[model samples]
Target: MSSHVPPSHRRWPAKTLAALTIGAFGWIAPAAAHFQELIPTPPLVNQNTGATVTLDMTFTHPMDHGPVMDMGAPKRFGVLVDGQTTSLMDRLESISVEGKAAYQASVPLKGPGDHIFFLEPAPYWEPAEGVMIVHYTKVVVDAFAADEGWDAMVGFPVEIQPLTRPYGLYTGNLFSGVVTRDGKPVPFATVEVEYRSNGLIEAPDEIFITQTLKADANGTFHYAMPQAGWWSFAALLEGPEPMANPQGDMVPVEQGALIWVNTQDMPQPSTN
Candidate 1:
């Protein structure tokens, strides 16, 4: 059999072929949930650097994989312990992650107790969404088994008050939290959940990238993590007031109350 093929159809570079195929289908992956990731070096510090914990802060979509967005200097950074909060903003150091502006800070754990480190990032101007984005994020570190202050709130415009213990959990435990804005429950608020990807898992569909759930009348929701890794729950709501955009026009604020908790796989029974 003799057939003549077009010159362009004879051969193509791998990269060029990929680009052509994608362009032909007009294929685009789903946008990931915009999460303010305040991940500590160690989710739990048993014995640490002079009782200090280092945290890496970035803004990105954790589930759909990242095209990490640049994070500006945070407005506030602090830790709450024994019902009291102390400012740590002066400790923030400029850094880069995935080629985007990010921050790193070390928080000193002063005593035998659980400390909740929280950050109020400067409002990020998301041009695509045409609104300012801000995420008030918090994570808990337990020291010396004091086991207190895990339920304390950081008093952001929006915050998550954990109903379940925020730490020391095996995988498959039910994690629960109450969504609050201004110290009041937000009835039926929308919450988005994402797992910190290990780069080996793929989403079955666009909708599967960021799992969504609605809170009950009391603004509480819960989920059982299927795998062992850091999981984030974000409760999103509208800001109280609109902020002026670059064009000097008013635009709504997209605010989020995000919390991170880590889980470990259950140990198998030992055989004698």
Candidate 2:
């Protein structure tokens, strides 16, 4: 039951080197082989409801005659929406443990915001089950454009924040709005969110999030919980400088840094 077993680093002891050389007609023994590297990557996609989202998680290895192990059943896959995790689908396209196919998945833009997804191989390894190691992939999707009139800023989104798990709310969730130049909303602007840890930046422990959202009419937007982590939200104006309100002010679409927000602490995922 010990999980800290040491790795086999050496081939033989010091004394064995002499005898092995003289055992045969100078028949030099072949080198020891290393364990095969797994399918380095996991498949990911911005699947939508009613849309065909292809499932292509092919790795560096080949398909017909590659170094892949069958998972018999697709039990090692899972899915997550925005921030609330969901179960992986079983009826996918012509795909296996290491295959790829054009799948159709309907992206549900039921509302305006950013939807983030994380895809990775199931961690548990078993010969009776499949591969020796596991992996995962990640992706993001944005559907919005404000200022022109198609923004959700004027009113609440169709999808309300859930009060509990499977439909609950979290603090890491992000919100954005159309930035105006001269009392006018900037249409079709993009917003990005980054994380800062202990006042320092660029640290992996406090890295930036790849996900971004678009602004709707009137220059407003929002991105739901993508993950359970500390983050700073920022807004930008894609269009030209807004004529100052006679006072003289100028700012770019890149709002420079993220806006800090307070989030409620929640329990970590249960291992059971």
Candidate 3:
């Protein structure tokens, strides 16, 4: 997320504007990773009755850990279960994080199965990249020991259909998913991976800010977590149509299909 300086409002020279919009260093602005996060408390729901889960939705760089961007009200929020979807957008409450606008919501788990929570946020304008971003984010919460429906797709413009069980993953386990756009596999897609670095981990360099990989010809990709924490996988693709910026000009729209998964460490050996 870069500064939202509309070109119509700036008097910079054409060459300087091009350099800034293209993200150069020093004289130009560098592109930052934009991630729409929908992190849920407890990550899994064990009980059916009186089981309420809270989700924190925000736009930020998870690996970088700070400079939270303002997130407008989400356009869509819902849960998919047993091939059915329910809208929870009305339940979202305004929340604040890092002195920026964010959102939070609580969902009561009344049935036994996997509840797939999804969010489609309003497009964020990034002047430095000269594009708007719309990330369709999702997370899976297994309820009452039921194991079904973890891989069900909500049918967004872009989304990740998990090949591995999203929940119950161990730290070293390999996670995989297929990147789909308009319900079809997107071959050779770029997927960005980042961990929620909660001050315990440090990047060796800027290259480690967002670890990226490409999906296979069939649109499947894999990554193994190195430690226990929350990790996000974002598949970036260009939208079919451009969107209107504040300047009333048609600009590129970057659509991201993102999923968050939690991993736990193996048990300690004989601490007692």
Candidate 4:
């Protein structure tokens, strides 16, 4: 999370401008949308499962299975249960994901209710996009069949308030949520969606990689997931103020409100 620029990444302003010039006309392949992933192993915790769950945090293109990016130490990592927020920063263990810096944590389920895990990652500099990226990401783990409290908000700078129950969904079920920033609706906010790649499916084209949609006047959006897996919904917005880049130059910031949910295939009836 250090703002200091590494000598290896430091480059002259002229070269940076040249690279942008070339990229503007399509010399470089379009970069896939970045998604901050906060995924829980097993996704759901029930009476039949273990007492603890493992969470993986990483910055990457979930749909592309990555060339993962290095993630700095997070600014905040914690969980919310029954309106109480507990910091889990000390429990984070540094890990290598795809040979890139990432993090993992083991969280014990204290009791029944929805455990809302949230992360505020260090700002990431994306030279290609010429912006500092910060994604406030979260995921919900339902424990002991206590289905209440799934709609609680973490009070991030920007976030999605779910209109649909985020867990225990069947494939093709429609998901809905409202985009909010500073506790107010962000009308017509653009949301990017991606399915976590398991390496079994391939995108036929770039269009198939990331799906984009716009929230309505009420800052609400709805999407039906076509497959069974972990899916990410990211509501993108511009930060109110610019941030200093590696070069100490002020640049725009891309603030994202992200949430991850999982769906399963419905079991079919047995033949008599």
Best by lDDT: 4
TM-score of each: 0.87, 0.27, 0.88, 0.90
Which of 1 and 2 is the better model by TM-score? 1
Task: Estimate candidate 3's alpha-carbon lDDT, on a 0 to 1 scale.
Answer: 0.85
Q: Write the per-residue lDDT of candidate 1 for residues 190-260, one digit (tens) a residue.
A: 88899988456797878887788888989999999887888999987877778987688897687788999
Best by TM-score: 4
Q: After aligning candidate 3 to the native by TM-score, how far in Å is the CA of 255 from where it should be? A: 0.4
* lDDT per residue as tens, model 2, 1-272: 11111111112332256447676656443221111111101111123333233333332122112334333223233333444555445533335433532122333334433333323332223222111322222233332421121121111111112111211236554444344434355554444444323233332321132345666665566766544433433342222222222234332111111222223457789999
What overall lDDT, based on C-alpha atoms, would model 2 receive against the true structure?
0.31
Ranking by lDDT: 4, 3, 1, 2
Per-prediction CA RMSD (Å): 11.4, 24.1, 5.5, 5.7
Tell me the lDDT of model 4 at 135.
96
What lDDT score goes with residue 12 in model 2? 32
> By TM-score, highest first, what's the ranking?
4, 3, 1, 2
Model 3 earns a TM-score of: 0.88
Global lDDT scores for all candidate models: 0.81, 0.31, 0.85, 0.88
lDDT per residue for candidate 3 within 176-197, as digits (tens), equals 9999988999888888898998
- Score candidate 4 by TM-score against the native: 0.90
